[model samples]
Each structure stands twice: as structure tokens, then as C-alpha cells.
Target: MERNAIILAAGKSDKFAPFTYEKPKGLFCVKGDVLIERQIEQLQEAGVMDIYVVVGYMKEKFFYLEQKYGVKLLVNNQFGKKGNLYSLYVARNYLKNTYICCADHYFPANPYLNDNPENLSYRACTYLSGKFREFAIDYSDAKVITGFNVGGRDGMAMVGHAYMNEGFSSVFRQFLENEINDFGVSDLFWEEFYAGHQRSLTFYMKEYQAGEIYEFENIDDLREFDSEFLMNVDSDIITNICNTLGCVPNDITDINAINAGLTNVSFSFQCGGEKYVYRHPGGTSGNLIDRTTELFAQEKAGKLGIDESVINMDLSGWKISHYIHNARNCNLEESDEQLETIMDYLHRIHSVDVASEKNVKVFDNVAEANKLMEMASMIKGNLKREFAVLIEKIDILYDAVRADAKRLGYGLVLCHNDVYEPNFIYDSEGKVYLVDWEYAGMNYAANDVGSIICRYDFADCQIERYFRAYIGHELTDDERRFYYAYIPISAYYFFCWGLYKGSIGENDGFFFLSSYRNMIRFIDVALESYGIVI
Candidate 1:
């Protein structure tokens, strides 16, 4: 005897509202298991191996279940416009003796628990004892279904599961075919067919006690039953976010890719009529970036009004913040007034009060970057020769910086380690906003200056002007020399960044390769000045 299960999950689930706006009702979790996953498990326990899911709304989410459970998916393209019976019609070929259920419904125990594995066909129902308000049934003296009264005085309610034997399957298929061919009745529910053909077909009604089954009619209903249902759902990130903000998934109207960093991807989205920025951290092999500390710094910076408004963040490294409308990435090409404002902005960031307990250090960043380079060297092909040369040059730079460290006057202050041109956003209101704090930490302030010079290619005059603007005086000999050498070191670090990112198969506008070329040029110039071999 072949036993198969079919789950009707093709309806759009518009009644569920906000929750279904971003995900299908079938994917929602009650207690610990996703709604459909629970049904699949019960079917399996009942000795049914082949499970077919009919999906339509947000069908892509079902792919994960298909792979994990080894079930087949049948798509109903007209799901958005059609009803549940259309989903069943699409799976007509599998009408062989089968068990059918709804994706959005959950049963505490299998109704087919003790039945003979291959003997009979029955419709699962429940007597009225709870909030279930769907089709109410009337049974004959022989315990067969006589008719259904939708939303009528409910003594027995249809619970969305039924078993069909080969004989019943053949009759149901002919009823559907005749309805489609002769009466052109394609929009009727599968249960409606049983009602219309009661003279020719009868179903044994197997009723369960109330509280044994549930069909979620809305998000509020589901939330009331299980308070942590949002978190139980595998799509916790999206659902928890929507619930906390008092907004639905449909409120998130647009998601525009803002920028792609070596270790993070950012996007701008509009939610509930307000714009926000979302940061999605990328995968990394080693501890290249500490997101915990990064979030800490971001919180501190937001308090100081140096960063955007942070809405929500978690250890998972995903963040949502307020989006500044009409803000442009600041560069040296901006008017002198704008550049000076950006200079003041950087100084202000350096001046922010550092929490004494935050033990985040600067060299931790270099250690992280070094790990990336090591991982890259192991993975990347044909770059061994070039990488070897870069490493040698970096070693020389490291030695020189260490020998000169005592006299450099490099202040250990909070620094935005990646202060490239795009990291600074200038709004039309003349307020300079610093963004992308992925590498922010307590570091030598000079390192940030060097990063800006190399990143923007600031002319000697512009560099001098920025230094004067920031320090309120001319640069001391020690400061000037340290800044000059630090430029090449920063460039070299970024170049290794390119190699690391490329090895990981990341292709964000060829960022890593560009960093490599800049590193070579700066290394040669800075090394020649120090009387070191190029």
C-alpha cells in the first residue's frame, strides 16, 4: 500500500496580515517547529514517506524544507489569484490513496494514529469547544458526512485533514474532471465537491476532541497561543523586527543596496514611512572583526551624535539604523567648507569619551587583518609570488614603525580605522555624518589621518591644511614624519584586505584588487623616503 501526504499551502494567507506579508503562513513557527514542518513530522510518524507540498505565496521559503525533509514541491502559479482547491487540483496526478492536510494547521496528535495502515478513508473533524469557526458538519446515522454548514451552529468543525482510498480518489478525480469539462466549475473548493455529490460519495467522519487541533486565523491569534512564536519561526530576524517596531512586513516597502564592504553589506530601506539603514555582516574565517565591540563602539558613537540612529542590533551582526536622506559620500572634491566640516567631525569622534571598561585595542585590528592575509595565502592561487613580495615589504614597514614607535607621539584614541572617502556622509544641511564603523576601536589617531590621506589622495597642501584645521596649529616634526610613514602602512594593510577578500570569492566592485595597486604605489614611495629598499 502506497501512503503519501499532500499539504495544501498554496493560498496567499492574506487573512494573517502583517506576518504573512513577509513570509508564508506555512513557514511560521508554533512552539519550536515551523507550522509545515510539524505536519511533515506527524505524517512521517504515521508511516507516510512521500510528502508533497503545494506552494504559491513566497514559494522560495519552502525550498529549505524540501531539501531538509526530502519532500517534493508542486507550485501553483495562480495561488495569488486562486483559492485552496486550485492547489489540490495542481496535484491531481497524486490522487492515489493519500492523506491531505493544510500547511497552516497543526494537530496535536495524528488522527490516523491507530487505524489499519492500509484500510480506510476518513475526514478529520472536531466537536465545537474552542474558537474554530470554519465549516460545521452534519453526519448521517451511519456516521458518514451528510452535509457541511459553513460558520453554522458548529457541533462539529472541519479540521482540514482527510484520507482518500483508491476508490474515493477515483471518484474525486472524476468529479473534478467532469466539473472542469462540463460545468467549467474550476473555482470551487475540494470539500464543495463532496457536498454536491453526497448521493454518490460519503465520508466517514473521524472527530477529535477540542484543543487537539488549531488553524491560525491571524497573527494575533497565533501570538496569543504562543507568545514566543515569532522567535520560534526560523525567519526570526525579519519577524522579530516587524513585531518590535509595531509594523508589518508589508511596511518595509523597498530595500536598496547601499554599499558593500569587505566584511559587511549595507542596504537602505523604507519602513512605516520612515527610512532606515540595514547592515548585514558577511562571513569571515578568522576573528578579522569583532562585531560585539563594533556594536559597542557604534552605541557609544550614537550617544555622542557622531553616528546614525541605531534602531536594533544583535550578536548575529545584523543591524538596523536610521537612514539619512539626501546624504552624499564626502570626498576631497567637496567644497573647502564641507571638507573642513568633515575634519572637525573626525576630531570630534577622536574626542568622544571612551568607556574605561571597553578594553578594545587598536593592534587587535592588525592581528585580525593578518589572520585574513594568512587565510588568503592558503586559498588564493597564482598570487603566491606577488603575495610573498607584499609580505616582505610589509615586514620591513612593520620593523621601521616599531623602531620609531617611541618618538612618534601617536596618541591612543578612538579611531575609525577605515576612514576612506565613502565612510563619511555629508548631508545638505552641512552636518557631516561618519558611517561604517566596522573597524572602529581605540587606536592611534594618526592612523585615521593617514588612512584619509591615502584614501582621498590629499595633496601636500590639503594634508597640511587638514592637520592645521584639526590640531589648531601646524604639525610638529614628529607628527609629520609619523603621518607620512603611517600612510604606507595603512595602504599595505588595505592591500592585504583585497587579497583576503578576493581569496574568499568576494567581488564587491573589485575592491580588493584596487587596494593592492594603491598599496604597491604607496609602499614604494614611503619606503624610498625612509631609505629602505623598494
Candidate 2:
């Protein structure tokens, strides 16, 4: 007999707020496709033409889904008061010779049912973890005779889309008839009925790993599941999913060719008279969404302080942020005043009480320098041997200098961990905007000044003058020593970061190598200034 599939999607999913606040759990997407869409596709793949969705929460949203996907919708009126069994009972009329499944549980499409009825009757089960106290199973002959406290256990064979012969309705009806005076169906009904029937069977499925059955019980789980799914989704599938979200671009425009340090491809585009940057962090970083949101918040707060316009934010599975014009770069030699302005801007950003409230932690420079030493040790060939040795010397210098700074008790101040030229923006009004707040946090402020001096070709006098202005005092002998000391430390960090990027095929090794060479030159000059051997 041909089979039909019924999906139960009625729960309120209170645990997944903000994420599930506006949409039902069935509409949750992995990669680009919604769970309901995946479920439908799986059913279609299984050769089931007639599909029924039992929906209660956000039922109207599925109306279009039913029409678009050609599936029938069954409303569960008592969904709020009762549970899954009650929803099943309401849809019982459609259950004759049907396959029942839960809307939230994801499984691969496997159409071939066991031909042996005895074997087909089996239930999937597993031992529960200690923390998952709600899970229980009553079993016999590889089939579940009863189940209870089903939360947090993969123990109960998912029954939403279980195959049922014509006689299955009689069994289901009998189970419902014996329901306790309590309004909801008890967990014992299925066990009692299956045990009463001599033909029932059960089977334990393979344990779910990376690709299987990621049950979403909380927002964190949902985010993690989406990130993993996005990483594995095929390109064509991503296109379809983007189309479903109503944000797919008609034609690629201004590809930027610059990665925003995300997993997926992103580009700036104009849609509906509004300009925005559409980012597809396909799978590279799991925290891309959170990072994007934080950036938006920081930008808003920063703009307010400077009397600049607020940037509009539209975050999603794909990140979309405000598109800003590229600012002019100030000439390091001709624009000494501009350089000082930039330093003052940096000082203002560092002075702002942003990092402390956010609880941001800057990466340890000493630890980073040590990592370079380790990476140098791992190099195997003569061709890169000089570069490795150079890194080792730089690491040693950084360690000695950082130890001195700590001993002197130079108070930690907010520092921009990366103070490279590209990260500085000169607005048309000649105001300097320090962008890319990724590494902003509390640290030795000289580290920030040191990073800029090492990376950019600024005049030594201008550099000293800018530092003096920023800290509101002429540099003491110890302060100058500390700043010069951290120059190699910053260089060691950049070199290591570049190596790490290269190891991961990110194409940034050459930039780091250039910076490393510059640091060596700075080290010689600093030693001469300190009256130490060059």
C-alpha cells in the first residue's frame, strides 16, 4: 500500500527565544534550507506523494509552505494545552497506513522499509546520559514496548513518521481509548499497545555524530547546528536557500574580493533602494553572526560619540552591514599633523570605556611571540631556515622586553592590538577613524604605539611627538625603552599570525614576512638608541 507522512510541528519552543521568537521550529534553517523543507524533500525522495504537516505555533506561516510544496496542513488546536500525543490524536483520521514523524527531528532519506513486517516493527533506542533524567524506554525484542521522560535521550525511536498498516489505526485507536482521565496521552500507551501486540519489533540506530539528528533544544544548539550545516551545504543548495529567504542577489555586483574574515562569500549590493553589504560566511567561522552584531553595536556607539550617522544593521544567516565609502589614506611624510590627528583618534578610542564593559580580552603578545618560536622549530627545510631563525631571535627579544615591562609595573591601558596602516581611515573632513575593532582591549598602551611604528614608515621624531601628545606628557627614558621593546614583540606577533594564516591557506605569509624584516631593521635602530650592541 502507498504511504503518507505526517509531521508534528506544534510546540512553542520557548527555550529558543529571539531565534524562534517569530518563527516556528519547523522553519528553522540549516545551511540555507528550512527543516520543514528538508523534511518534505526527504519524504519526496522516499516516494511519498501525500505529505501532511501538523502545525500549531505560527500556523499561518506554513500556509504558504503547504501551497508552495503541495503538502496538506493539519491544525492542532490544543497544541498549547497538550503535547505530541494529543496532536497525533487530532490528526489520527489521516493516520491510516501513514508514516508519522516529528517536525523537529532530522534524519536522512531512507525509503526502503524492512520487507519483513516483524523486522519493520523495530524501534530505535540508546542509553541515556546521566544529565538527561527525562529519558526512559521499555523494550522487548528490539522494539520499544514503552517510553517515558523522553527529553535529552536519543533512546526513543522517533515515531512521527513511523509506518503504519491499515490495522495500525485500530491499534492507535485502542491506545487512545485507554488514555487516562488526564487530558494528554501518557508515555506508557505506546509501550502497552506494542507489548500487547505480538508482532511489534525494534531496532537501535547508529549514534548520531556530526551529520545526523542534531536535535535543537536551545539557542546555542540551533546556532551550532546552523553553522555546521552551512559548512557542508552544496553551492546549489545554498542558492535555493538564499532564494527562500528573499535576499538572493539577481546579479553579482562589487564583489569586493576582500574576505570579512568569515566562512562564506559576501558582497555589497543595492536592494529595494537601500544599499547594504551582503555577507555569506558559509562555514568558516561559527561566531560570524555574533561578531557582526557586536560590530554593528560598536559602530553605533562610536558614531554617536563622534556625531556621525548611525549605520543600519540587518543581520541574518547571511550578514548584511552598512556600506561605507573608502576613506583617503594620509601620506606618512607630508602629513605630520594628520599623523598626530590619527594618534589622537587612537587615544580617544583607547580612552573610551568600551573594552572594560564588553569584557574583551586581548591576545597575550608574549604567548604569540612564543608561538612563533614553536612554528619556527617545526620548519623542516633550509629554504625557510633563515626566516625561522629570524623569528626565533625576535621571539627571544620580545620575551626579554615583556618581562622587563611587567617588572616595571607599567599600568595596562586600552590598546589597539593591530595598529597597521590599512586599519586607519582618513575621512574627507580629515578626521581619522580607527576601524576594525577586532583586537581592541585593555593592555599595555605602548604595545599599540609600538605596532604602528613597526608597520608604518613614520618619522621617528613624529612618532615620539605623537606618543607624547597622546599620553599628555614627554616620554620618560623607561617609557621610550618600553615602547621600543614592544616593537619587536608586535612584529613577532604579526609574523606568527601570518604563518598561521599561511598554514591554513589564507595567503598572508608574504605580508607577515615583510613586517618581520621591518622589525629587524627597527631592532637595530632601537639597540643603537639604547646604547646596546646593534
Candidate 3:
């Protein structure tokens, strides 16, 4: 007797799209093999002589399979119009003690289908069985019972793929007839016939253990699936990431410097005779992976003339840029033009047209001020009185700033939120690179500009000249007012962020708090220098 198999590949996968837009669910590949092909290969390994495939959506793609593998093809005319049960019904005529299963699931194929005992009519169900879901046999007669959801369990009577015997076919035909009579019944016809029936002999098989199984359900899942492994590395992506900083993987002498950036963690490795940077995200707060994907999409869009090169992003995840060797440090005596380049780069990034949905407000001055006051109220240290007075002054200043902002109808742009000299990297060729984009979003542009200007001490003549050059134009009275106002507001925002970080016990929380305290002191000094009361 020849063994045969029928593959169910007709379901309309509505949930898996975009990723599945061009391919059928049956053709969805893991590693390299398509699901249906894997199923076919398994059946062949099981020594099944003939294989029948029920193809539906994008069935044309699988037409070559019959010629390539010499398998039989059964088409379901109502493929997309009907469900799996209908597809099964259309292939009923081809059933000859055949092994029927879904194409989507991964299972092994071995042990010729004809090798199973002819006396047994049912195979055991593995998933939903027993207390521990373990296979146990009755000692007296070596019969299986009590554990089977239907009735029999271990040797009570075993069934495998051999059930396609003439008697079983008659039972199956009767099952289909019963389903046809119950026209209003919404349940799958096969479930009613096979699930609770006692006559169906059942046997247990070991669990299929190979690769992990994951059911893709949504766009997020698709994104996750794509990111789970590297994409086509043979593309220009690896080269682009290497050229970003004028250095290759070999140039990373001090691995510590390479790992300093908080956005991503990087490892050096060689692939296909070339070195590469393999970086993973540092998680959600600063989602490096998501940012890399967005940057890659934007770059592709820009190349197609669909968008502007606002961020100057390179390839995705592992970006390669011309690494600047022997980069010059920005000293107090640095030329005005050097400072201008840094400020311009920062301005370009802060003014990019980020989508409104991604434009999240990370910090609000009023709310931050209130949080600081609350923190002050909770303090039991020696600086309690000083903190109390400072909170009161901060509240008054916050209210004044809010009122002024409302009166002026000022709108926000993307601000770095954390702008300091260290975050700005200057190459030896005079190009500037902004490192961290974690706190980047829509906010007052003055907040970033003010933070940069205030944090760096420019008491020297050349430094002050550099500062003036950085802005390109003299600050207007209104702009100056906002800049000065932002100093304290930004300080309070940092202070609150520090307190939150401290509450969560994040790494170096005290360091952030100390930095916030320094910023506060700087704000007070700026106010005194301008002869303004807090």
C-alpha cells in the first residue's frame, strides 16, 4: 500500500500582511525554506510516495511544485471565499488513508506512514491529554483510558496516520454528511467528527522539537521578526556604518570609548571577509534599533527625493561613516568658525520635521517645578530651609515664564533637552557630530541653545567671540529674554528628571543630581550677572 499526504495551504492570512503582501502564508520562510516546502520535504522523508497540496491564495506561485516534486495538486475554487473546512471537503475525494496536516506548523516526517499498526484506527493527541499530559498505560490489559479527552489513552487502542482504511473513510463520509445536514452549525465539521468521538482510535507521538515556533500577528510582530536577525548584509549597509566616523572596526582601539554612547551597545566582528560593527539597542528609553530603522527609511526616502537630509543619517543599525582621525578638542581658544559649525549642526538636527505622533513632550517646566517643590517638601537633610526657599523662588519663576510664554504664543521645536559641550564632537576636519539623540523631541529651541551657551564658560575674549559666531547673529531682546528664562526652566526640568532617576535608583543617579545642582547654581549666577531677581 502506498502512503500519501495532503497539505492544507488555503487559509487567507489576513493578520500577516505588509510582510506577507507579496507572498502566501504557505510560502513564509524560516531560515531559508518555505513552510510548504518544509512540509513537503518532511513527507518525502517519511517515505510518502504521493503528496497532494491544496493551494489557494497566490496558488500560481506553487504551480511549479507538481513538476519539481512530482506531487499532486488540488485547487479550491472558493479558496479565498471559504474557510479551511471547505478546502478539506474539496480534497476528500483524494483521501486514501492519507496523512493530513496544516502547512503552517513545523513537524518532522519519518517512519513510513504504512509502518503503523493496521489494527489501530486512532492516534493519540499530544497537546491536550492527561494530568501531566504524559502518556500512561493501564497495567491490567495495557489499554489506554481515562486520560484521553475523547476516551482511550495508552494501549487502550492506538491510531496513527493509518486511519485512512476503508472503514475510517466511511466514518469520515458520514461525519461530512452530518456536517452538511446541520447547515446552521458554525463549528468546524472535522472537530465535531474527530474531537469527542470514542470510536476514533488515538495514539501518542513524541513532541516535534526543532526550531521555536512563533505566530506573527501584527505590524509590530513583523518589525520584530525583521529585526530578529541581520538583513541582507551583502548590501552597502556594512560599508556605510564603517565610513561614518572615518574609522573601521580595526580602529576601535579602546573598546570602552566605542561603548560610551548610551543609545547602542556595539561589538566588533568579521563577516564575509570584512569587519563590521554589530550593535544592539540599549532598550526603550533610547531605542537605538528603532532609531536606526527610521534613519534607514529616511535615507532611502531622501535618495528617492521624497524627503530632506535633515539628520544626515547613514545606513541602519550598523552605520559606517568616515571616522575623523586625530580629531581636535574644542578648547577655549578654538576659532569662531569651528564653533559655528558645531552650532549649525545642532540647529539642523533640532529643527528637523519629525512627525507629530513622535513629537513627545518629555518634560514640562511647570510640572517639573512642582515636582522639585514636592521633593523639597520631602527632604529631611540640613539644606531643608534652603531647599524650601529655593522651591518657592522656583515656583514663582516658573509661573512668570509660563505666563510670558502664553502671552507670546510661542511654539516649540525639537530640542536636545541635554545640550552640553561634551555631547558635541568636533572632528579634526572641522566637521561637528552630535552624539546623543535620546532627549530629542519637539520643545523650545531656545532650551537647547540656552543650555549649550550657559553650560560652557566663555569668560575669555576668543571664547565669547566663538559663542557669538556660533549663533551667527546677535541675539534679539525677545530671544535673549527666552534664552535667559530657559536657563532656570531647563535647570528645573533637569532637577526633576534627576529626582525621578534617583527614585528609580538608576545608575549614576547621584551624578545627574549633582549636575542638576550645578546647573541651578549656574542659573543663579546668570540672573545675578544680568541684574535680575529670582
Candidate 4:
């Protein structure tokens, strides 16, 4: 009876954040041995010598396993954007008589066995009372799994390791092949895929004693198990965070990656019983953000009661903000209920006195972008023609915008500067708060309007509607022209920003194309409005 194992080491879970940023959880050295390597040894001892390691999210680091353990590596390239079931889907052909295992789990003793090679089973452990968090299992009197739950207590909890006989794998392969193209199915894990169809299937629970199946759910668990956790001593992200917070690395716990912004990488962590988000500067971020100005603007927005509390921010673009829990970003669809509050916040934000901070407007951004365009070797090689045309019209576009902006009779003031959908958060109290002040500065309030419009690609009527709500007035010709002029300027600035970001390998795929196309479209419209050209 020949059997093989599929070790899922692909998707990177942020539950083990700073530790798993560069080194995947599979590679973590747990209790004097790497996690996945220990699993490999156990599987080999169980006579499952022929193994396939599904690798992604730093797959190159697993290349040594092929030489060291003689295991085949099946690479899942879309690992960052896809879920774990896709990993199994890639290894679907080899699921026969297979032990399906997760790479990050640990066991004090060998759990892999070939004695029950013909049985379809999932490993589980008892969680008695007091409300457990893992997937709880319900089984029939014959030891067959009948159902599973997410928030149940006093029952079997899934340990994420399973085995499938040839008959089960044969049918599962069909499910995998059929569901590969199914929408929303790729988001679930293989266990979840099975759980969805549990009524039609039978999986006997291989029950383990409580605490036998080990998973380090948090930093405290790892440190309690091993005081000399390398995440504290070796990780620079931890060192910088602790040094700034004036605490040791062990004080930080429950680290998770937040929604990664285009300008910054953020992660949520708990320290001193306070949860906060740490923003790490992303690629090309240093040149893009002036942190001094950002600090001033963010502090001002906070004072206005329209932003989260900032814990610490420095000149290097590293920042910590008080995390807003139970909140979601706006959809920015034309019909959203949150739009009125968001519009009110924008107007309130523009009233701040920013006389002390340096003003950064669309003109300044365009000048900075021109430098990025020339230095971008990729763009210089391919987009030279389009770049040349936009470069030639920069002066025309700026001059038109500047003249129209003068018609407003009020000078530039502070603004959120980048009023995209994700920058606005509606907390549980139904309060709309602005965030991500990296681009904030003393810019025309028109820039905010330009930002929301260009970022969301708003139509003419929707634009008119929001602008009407923003100003609370009828369409004044000068005000409309002023905003229309910013459309081209903002679009061009975004296009060049994309050029710079693209050169640094932060390729914003569709954003770059659409920004360039919109820049051309609005540039022509601005010129036509000025009655300068055809």
C-alpha cells in the first residue's frame, strides 16, 4: 500500500505577523526544529515517504526541502490573493491514499499513521465548555461527523489535518475540478469546502486527547512555551516597534496585518492592553510622503473629531494609530448611506488652520511626478511616446487649473488630500472618520473633490451631486470650472505616481492604465473648456 502526503505550506497567515512577514509560518523554528520539517519526519516515519509540498508566499525558501527531503514541490503562484483550498486544488491529482496536512500545526508526538489507510478521517480534539473559537465538530453515534460549528463549546474542534482513502479522493477530485471555476469557492479552505457538503459525505473523527494537537495562536502562547522566541530577538520589525513603544517585544501580542494601503503597509497589534495599527513605509514611500506635514495634518484632523487618535508618527513615515474596531470602509457606490456624513467630514476638514505646515497642491505633485517619470526605466523604455505627450501638456494643464482655481476667491487650506473610499471609516457608533493622512497637506479643498472623483471614476451627475452636497449650493459656473480643471491635474498626477510606483515594482495593474487614459481624456477636456484647442 503506497501512500503520499500533501503538505499545505502556501498561504501566509497574519495571525503570526512580524514572524511570518519574511519567513513563512511553515519555516518557523518551533522547539528546536522547523515546524514543517518536523511534520515531514513524522510523515516519513509513517511510511508516507513520497510527499508533495505545496509552496507559495516565499516559495523560494522551500527549495532546499527538495534536496534535503527528496519531496516534490508544487508551486501555487497566486498564493497571496488565493486561499488554501486552491493549494489542494493544485495537488488534486495526488490526493489518492493521501494524508492532507497543514504546515504550521505541531504535535508533541507522531499523529501520522498508515494503519487506517482506507478510512476518510479528520483529526480533532475536545474543547470542554467555556466557549471555544476553533471549528467545533458534531458527530453521529457511529463516529461519523454530522456537522461542524464556528463558535460552539464542549465538542470536537478541527485540527486541520485529514486523511482520504482512494474512493473519497476520487470523488473529491471531481469536486475540486468542478469548483475550480466556481465563483467565491476559491476563498474557502479544503476543510470548509468539505464542511459545506458535509450532509452528503461521511468523515469519521480521529479524536485526540485535549491539548495534544498544538497550534501557537498568539505570541504569548509561543513565549510561554519557549521564552527565547526568535521573533522577539531576531525580527527588526519587532525591535523597532518595541523601541518606539518603550516596551520589550514580548509585550506585543495578537499581531495581524491590516488592509495594506498603496502608500503604507499596516498591521494591528495589542500592547499594554491597547490595540493599535503600525504603518510601515511601503516601497517608494519615502519620496512620496513628507511625514512632518502628515503629522501636522493628522493631528489637526484628530482635533476636528473626524480622525482616529495617533499614537506616534515620525519623519520616516512610520506611524501608529489607535485601531478602530468594528468598522468597515465605505463601498463608495453612488447609493451608499454613508456619503452624506463623509461629505460633511470633508467640509469640516478643509476649515482647519494649516498656516504652520507647508502647502502641497496638485502643481507640486505634478513637478515631483515629472522627476519620477524620467527615472522610471520601465516607463522610459515602453511609454516614452505617451510620457512625452503628457509632459508637453503639463504646463497647459497646470495653467488652466491655476486660473480656474483663482476664481474661487478663497486660497488653499488643509484637506485629507487623498479622499478615496478606503480612507474613510464608519465606526460602530455610525461616526465617519478620515484616515491615512500620508498625502495630507495645505491643498485646495478642490483637491479632495478631485481625489474622490478621480479615485472612484465618478460620472458627471454623481460628481455634480457630491459637489453640490459638499458646497451645499447650486452649480456656480466658476466653482464647477475650478473642480473640472482639477480633474485633469489629479489624473495626470496619479498617472505619474503610478509610473514611479511601477518602476519600484509596486505594479498597480489596472490603476496605471486607467489613470493614464483618464489623464488624456480630462487633459483634453480642460483645454477645450479653456477654448485653446480642438
**TM-score of candidate 3 versus the correct structure, residues matched by position:** 0.40
277-348 per-residue lDDT for model 4 (tens digits) = 887777467777877777777777778777856777777777777888788777656435677777778878
Local distance difference test, per candidate?
0.71, 0.57, 0.50, 0.75
**Reference-based TM-score of each model:** 0.56, 0.45, 0.40, 0.65
Residue pairs with backbone atoms closer than 3 Å in model 4 (clashes): none
The TM-score obtained by model 2 is 0.45
On the 0 to 100 scale, the lDDT of residue 241 in model 4 is 75
* Most accurate candidate by TM-score: 4
Q: Over the stretch 1-534, how does candidate 1's per-residue lDDT look in tens digits?
A: 768888998886656544464588888878877889988988887778799999987888898887788899999987755556677788988987788888988876775565545456788887775544577788878778888875655488777688888788888878776665345255666777677887777688887776788877766577768877645555554664576577765465555565456676666667788888766665461246667667777876777777766777766677887777688777655467766776666787788676674566564334555766677778875454756777677677767665666556445677778876777776667677777777878776767776766554456687677666656778776566556667667766676677676675665233445455556656766666557886
Estimate candidate 3's alpha-carbon lDDT, on a 0 to 1 scale: 0.50
Of the pair 2 and 3, which is ahead by TM-score? 2
TM-score of 4: 0.65
Best by lDDT: 4
Model 2 C-alpha lDDT per residue in residues 353-423, reported as the tens digit of each score = 54335544545775755554455445522324556556555555655566667788865555567676665
Better of 1 and 3 by lDDT: 1
Better lDDT candidate (1, 4): 4
Instruction: Give candidate 2 regions above 4 Å deviation.
Output: 1-266, 278-320, 354-358, 372-396, 403-409, 427-431, 457-474, 524-534
- A best-first ranking of the candidates according to their lDDT comes to 4, 1, 2, 3
Error of 3 at 289 (Å): 13
Q: What tens digits encode model 3's per-residue C-alpha lDDT throughout 431-453?
A: 55555454554566667765554
